[model samples]
Target: MIQTDGAFGRPTRHAPPLLNARHAEDYWQQATRCIDLVRRKMASVDRPFTGAHPEELKRLFEGIDLDAPLGELRPALEELERVYLDDAVYFHHPRYVAHLNCPIVLPGILAEAILAPINSSLDTFDQSAGGTFIEQSLIDWTANRIGLGQDADGVFTSGGTQSNLMALMIARDHYGAALADHGDNKHEGLPADYRRLRILGSEVSHFSLQKSAAILGLGYQAVMPVACDDHFRMDPAALKARLEECLAMSLIPIAVVATAGTTDFGSIDPLEEIAALCRAHGIWLHVDAAYGGGLLCSRRYRHRLAGIEHADSVTVDYHKTFFQPVSCSAFLVRRRSDLRHVTHHADYLNPLCQAEAGTPDQVNKSLQTTKRFDALKLWLTLRIMGADALGEMFERVIDLAGEAHDELARHPAFEVLLDPPMSTLVFRYRPADLCETELDELNAYVRAALSRNGEAVIAATRVDDKRYLKFTLLNPDTRLEDLTAIVERIVHHGRAWCEAQAPTRAAAS
Candidate 1:
């Protein structure tokens, strides 16, 4: 409770005020204690997760009052440790190979500590003077690395989804204006023929493109899915045929979205070929390299994204492959002028006069007004670990995936899919006696069983209507032996499920 009758009418609260000199020690001590608890928890990474059920979690949290304080910091942190930290999924653990979540580097963690206390918003220059420059510098560095031209500019976004959204939004407005006799879509509504506008992408491209179309008022129907080859990469010839068909039908092509790294198979599309097609069609090319953009620094695998420089815009999520924490991603454009489509100046935040006077405000280029200082995390990471060191870590994980792929291929019970283009391996359990339907059920059962036991964590996806298991190797510490053991555990669960099903099948028959 706050007492309003204090000196100078300042409220006297149970919690210390931000600049209260008397309670400074108390604040420092409590923060240090929390940090210590985190360090201990991180060090003890024996289990990937506690496998807490939904009902159990609901029971544990149901009694807590959101508005009420728990009192002392020690008791509060202890309660958090018991109810949240203990049961939370540990991505740093070697067995946790389920998603694109990467084990964060030390410097990134340190940056979080620093940024949280300061609480600087990177939106306006007045709010974050040096912060704006730092973020812009990081974006410029990333743009240069991508080989985007001198006019390349970008803004840090919350994640890849937002970046993808911004990219499509820019593309839509750019082409829509041309179609509407150079009218502004922001001032005037989308052209009357917006229904015929279409964006092209591979069938395996991220679903964000479809969502972007819907958000842009183009409707989800406006997205045209191109065919992918056997390797799960976009087929250039098929894309060409589709473009020709669209032209014949008088459908306007807005943008061509190419996936540099798809989620399930980690496949890299034919970027150079796709760029050529987009160039010929005079359409905007946006590459969603959220998962594969880290390869820009990878000494050994940089050639995989050879034609990314030709992209009109690109989305890169550092959290996915650059060993950074979540919410660190950027939307980069080849020409800085393209971003003006999304810029709307407000009198209060970033006035048009201020921008014209050469003031650099981040909100002018971002969809978000109050943005986090996420670039600091990447800055600290680069300074401490170096780009080459990060690249080597990525290389290790990619190599581990190859080794795991080979092991799965040689194993008698497992059927390995295509060799990984990056660091994801898709495979499934297959017994000689069981049919395809039974095998699918067995593999799904195996995944559930492993998840329930909390021994290992992996992912599952469907390819060509068939269920398959996936191991997304983003943890650099995860070794070939650990992957092999996880595969063995999966096999064990699969065999047990198959045996249990045999008697039931016989009875049914």
Candidate 2:
């Protein structure tokens, strides 16, 4: 409780002053202790989750005074532990192969330690002097990696979703500009037939494309999903057909969105062939490489994303593949001039004269203002550990996926899907005695049981209305032995469920 200096017992809302030169020692002591608390918790953690039920946890936070302070950092942090840290999901655990979350590298953490205290905002040159230039350098380097050529330029975004949205937004305005004679399409708003403008994406592409279309005044239906081949990759022939159909129906194809790495299947579309189709149709080609962009660092697997250089725009999530922390992603364009669509000038912020005077205000490059110094994390990651080291870590996981796939296919009780083009594996448990109907329930039970026990955690998804399990292998430290143990636990729980149901079935029969 805060010390009450008032004459009465009434509580005061204020506790402490803000950090400044006088508070340097206080900040140092508090920050160190807080970081140590997390370090100890993380190091001592055994499982990915604590299996804490939602309702049970919600009760802990049921009633708290809105205006109250513990008056000390230690007490507040201790309270936070009870509600959050104690039961928080630790993605660093090798058994937590449920989603795209990756364990961060040490250099990224070190960079965060520095950036948090400085609190630099990257919106303008005056705000973040060296920060703006640092970000520009990283963007240029990433564009070079993607082979986007000399005219390439981009800006850091929150994540894949924001990056994809910006890419689609640019595609929309760029097409609208060409359609008109002489005017800024963005200022005049979407074209007269904006409803008819469609974006073609692979059937297995990220759902963010549809969300982006909806946000850009086009309905969700504006995103037309083309067919995929048996390998779960976008069929180039199918894409060609869709493009021709768009012309026949008098529907303008604003962009052809090809996925370099799909979410569930990890299958890469035929980028070169799709680029050809986009070129012939005079459509903007945007590649959503959020999952597979790490391939740029690998000389071995870089060929997989060969034709990405031809893309008019691309999205890459460094947090996902490069082992950086969350909210580190970039949206790159082939031509630097294309970024003018999202550029907005304000006298108080980035005025037109600032750009003319060659002052680098990142607000002109991004749709967002007051963005974080997320680029610093990536910058430090590359500086401390070279790109090759990150690539090797990524390569290890991809190799493990191939080995895991082969083992799952050979195993009698599991049904493995296509071989991953990157590092995610989609599969489900299937006993020979069970049919599809029983298998769905069993797989769902297995996933839930593992999660409830707090031993291992995995993912579940639906494939064409058919429920299946998934293993998104992003941890380099996750050995086959660990996967074997997870598989065994899944089998044990599934068999238990089946045995319990057997008595009911026999009695009914």
Candidate 3:
């Protein structure tokens, strides 16, 4: 016979009531202590990368015995809590501007903490009944945004990288269906008529396309990068010339990748021109709108991504511009049938007939068998905030970027590179008397020093081989003050570094 504690039964020895009483008391005490620690840690404002009391961690795990008793475990756990609680960079703090990651909404974070551990996997209906439906709903919602009609299909991928890979997979299979039947002679030996597959994109297209090329059995050499115009948009004439060259070389131009918004400068490529070129060439057109897709929400800025509707497929990373947390990304296709190219059969899992019937099996449409229902966060965000609210948020950020451009230009010590086409402003830290080389080095040093000191987080990139600092204003919480403050710090630090180098330059001279 098992004795219970009025809740559930644990395997017990023939121990006395006092022993169990001590165990329950000990658990409550440790839990209360942990809760208090959490509360205090969150309430503190320093946002320290390392906690104040690092040495106290040594005592945390030293005296604990796991097998002794539940009562005996409290002291050890208290130590464990002390060691690991408050040593992370607080992204929620307004200064975190390094990458495209967004500060998560409070409700979304709460939903993730609760639902993630409960309904863990979204691979099949049995494992994630409601979760599968929710993910599908989000996919359908995104498809509608692309004007894909009822026959459209999409899948939530890990991020922009995986989405680009999936797009390549669909394009490759659609162009090379013979490989599905015979596993491709190249897998065993090169075929006599093996023609190189070519992909064309602006030089500023995301590096993910190169990675996608490598993964799709096409070498990086196979991906041809066409030149972009002065504003970094792809030039259709350049792309047409490259396509003509590829044709003359007898290379199969498999896909044309257009950038709706580039990574470095947020420069939108000539999408309408590229789309028309792709149609003329009978090539698959994929618009990599990962950064610019959020412009879909803004009527004022939507014209920037014109001809996106003509894309055979498009990739969108909601985390970058939509302010959705990371991994809420997808690839949208013009036709649902294109996804059939990535389909496969497993005897134990999705059988032939079930997939053929299209019973809403996400695995059939994805490269990943076991996927996360990352779409829930987006769904919940939309349901609560509505599309207009998110769109307005995007517009506000773009508006702020414009303001930043004007202000940075007005500052005597700074040189704003170009008008922020989207939300990214690329600029150099130009001091009053610094030469070209000195100014460039000073700016670079400032960026490195700020990142090292953890005072602020900003991005650095190269355009035409010259390094420039970039501000990607993805966070709606980030204000004009935040941008100006960081720019001021960069100027101050850059000037200091340049002054310090003056004596060295004189000595060398």
- Per lDDT, the best of the predicted structures is 1
Residue-wise C-alpha lDDT for candidate 1, range 260-352, written one tens digit per residue: 999998999999999999999999999999999999889999999999999999999999889998879999999999999989999999999
Candidate ranking under lDDT, highest first, comes to: 1, 2, 3
- What residue runs in model 1 are displaced by over 4 Å at the alpha carbon? 1-11, 14-16, 19-23, 180-182
Pick out the ten consecutive residues of candidate 2 with the lowest summed lDDT. 3-12
lDDT of 3 by residue, 308-334 (tens): 888899899887777776678888899
TM-score (C-alpha) between model 1 and the true structure: 0.96
Q: What's the CA RMSD for each of the models?
A: 2.7, 2.9, 5.4
Candidate 1 achieves a global lDDT of 0.89
For 95-122, candidate 2 gives per-residue lDDT tens digits of 9998899999999988898888899999
| Sliding window of 10 residues with minimal summed lDDT for model 3 | 3-12
Model 3 TM-score on a 0 to 1 scale: 0.85
Q: What C-alpha lDDT do the candidate models reach, one value each?
A: 0.89, 0.88, 0.76
Q: Candidate 3 — which residues are off by over 4 angstroms? A: 1-43, 46-87, 178-195, 432-436
